[model samples]
Target: MKEHFKVTQRMKRGVRIAGLALAFTVCGAMAWPGGTSRLIRKADQAFELEDYKAALKLYASAVEAEPSSPEANYKLGITYVQLNMPKEARAALQRAIDLDAKVEQKLLLPLAEANHLEHNFSAAKAYYEQEKRSAPTLEKTYQELLRKRIAECQAGEDLMRLPAIYNVSNVGSAINSEYSDYVPVLMPDDKAMLFTTRRPDKGRKSLDANGAEQIRITRMQQGNWQESELFLETQQQMPQHAVVSVAPHGKELYTFFADKGLHVSYKLQSGDWTQPELLKAPFNQGSREPSLFVTDDGKFAFFSSDRTGGYGGLDLYVSYKKEDGSWSEALNLGPEVNTPYDEDAPFVDTATNTLYFSSRGHNTMGGYDIFRSSISNATWSKARNLGYPVNSAADDLYFTLSSDRSTAYISSDRPGGAGEKDIYRILFH
Candidate 1:
């Protein structure tokens, strides 16, 4: 699971240098509120150890105590970046720049990254250029990576300019809670929607602060998704269970586990769901598998796994169902559909032979972006980003297209949402 947090070597070098620069800022003011050298030291230590959540709290305290401390705001902004929250990062970084103009030059890369992630391409490009002016002072490799970031900003700017024609809106409060609700699986019939949510579980004593993930379902009635209720048949099976794929008939469901890989549950003729059965052999390789996408007929399945032989931390793999009802050895989707970076959440449209997923590779604007690739001539084409609003600078993932392809849904932690993450619906043009 920790491997999921790993970044590329180039990014590591940039962050390391940027962090060292941030650590040395002079704290000249005395009697500043919440400002303490001790707090800064502790935050810095936590940040250096990649304990971003802890560093975020400490830095927030430092900023509260010393609102005038440019360094504190800078640290808070960068901490937010590490936490994959670019909107908050941009605000904190901007405040730091306002407090001390010099802090802008020191935090140019983070400012660029945060803005880029938030889809503010112009601001991100400007910051990248400003950082580029001083790029010669850094290592050669990092400078090259910085150039790539600048190009990424330019790409994002271009994409944002030619916006897609789609009506995007929140799915409404009735089906959403103050907590995160994501990874939706809308059945082919479109009558029921199943998803994972982090709303409080009153029965779990060892739940995390965000609450244990549980599966919930809501029905569509009179053209609106009604209020949500737990998917009782498979509820409470795992402390952190998530529904990844549902059969075309909505009678079978697939879920992932850190210890067991991917498993499935079937609804019997009595209309009660059976206990989740661990998928056989190739699908249950006993590593950290996070997502699963199966074909409607159950002939093939695509799943995300971090097991060995991957091109990146997690790569998408497909396994075919053998004649005997067993599975063939998992086959990597190859470099076209995957990259030297993590890829997850594979959704296949067998009708069009299209595959949609989220990836940290392939010309991403920032963080993870949703991408789609279709098969032609028996090979997958280059993955294309879903673009602009459907994808954001934060980790935009868990995308599901409706049966008719006229509507789509995605989960994101992007700002202006109800909580940590929210499901959004987009009506295609």
Candidate 2:
């Protein structure tokens, strides 16, 4: 998943931020001092607006001003969760519970989630079970979701016992910055790569501005990746462009535009790319279609969409190229591969006819985890989680492989990362 689009959804789904009125009620009941009360109110406003950085600062001040305030600590903890700082969230949330046992009713789930994200599966499972036994009145759907989360924590516990054989490492400063660098699309030969970065451009003050998500390209020189440069051709006209997939031979590029849908650009013989052309019907027919994978033979294409009639949120679908050079109607990958939660960022290895994607359902430890299912006799096998450290408690998606399969790339916000989401290189042993 692209960090910009999916992170917000993941945070909202996991934490379910409360309203400003609730914060005020808690503050009013506690009778917080004047200065701390003002800070909490302003912090709640920033948090509601999704300005997490600003909210984090304000919440921290509120906590400092009134160390014993359960409401301030609870808000601070949730803000840390939004910023992907699970360790800090764990500290603040645990402190809130210590200060006021009643705050546990409000923060128990987030506390469990913080522990899950920190890879403390056993502790998280205990907390989740406690919530289940205590909250007998939770809505039916939410109860079902809680059961899934508890199962996921159990899965995390079991999967940790059998870690996969892979050496995962950061892609380094050449391709990563303190902002976000993700959705890496490597050229077939492995000499060049294309990716999306949320790093602010020159003269830009904030990532929230237009054109913040820009496509960049870098090439290997002397056994190291050269510093990246903006793919100027993509930025010349569009304010937002994300590279979805690159043709096997690197002659064509598939990109997504906010207003124009999926587009394809061809590389001319003169070493320049043509203006991207929007793909016609049967593609991009929904509110969101963010990822794509085309086979080397160009006979089939797999993509993710949230269009109507899907089993739930986003589901994977496939379309075949017709004899006349048009795409056929899409066929859903079906219930075996998709669940009530989102499935996205499809990639295929034609050699084995395996489909790889990220999903919020299945046995995900917390957020999205990569899974693989192969086609046999025209049916996709049950999806299998790739396991840690290729996947962590944090969201991990956009898994891409080198032609030889010796190395792969994925985007994740796992702990110790250089930024919000950084591209990681996984070497299969």
User: For every model shown, what is its TM-score relative to the native structure?
Assistant: 0.83, 0.89
lDDT values, one for every candidate: 0.76, 0.80
Q: Candidate 1: which pairs clash?
A: 33-65, 33-66, 34-65, 35-65, 117-393
Scored against the true structure, residue 67 in model 1 reaches a CA lDDT of: 83
TM-score of 1: 0.83
Which of the numbered candidates is closest to the native, going by highest lDDT? 2
Which residue segments of model 2 deviate by more than 4 Å? Answer: 1-36, 65-68, 202-211, 233-236
Model 1: residues >4 Å from true position, as ranges? 1-65, 79-88, 98-102, 129-148, 205-209
State the lDDT of candidate 1 residue by residue for 1-429, as single tens digits: 122123324353333224233322322222334445699889988876655667889999988988888778878888787665777988998898898776666777777777776777888788778877876675454565667667666767766877677887889886677678899899879888998887777775323445777888899999999998888744575777778999847788897654556778898899888888888878766667889888989899888887888886689999988899898999999999888668989899888999999987787766578999999997999999888878766667888888898888888877677766889998999
Compute the lDDT of residue 164 as modeled in candidate 1.
Answer: 74
Weakest ten-residue segment in model 2 by summed lDDT: 15-24
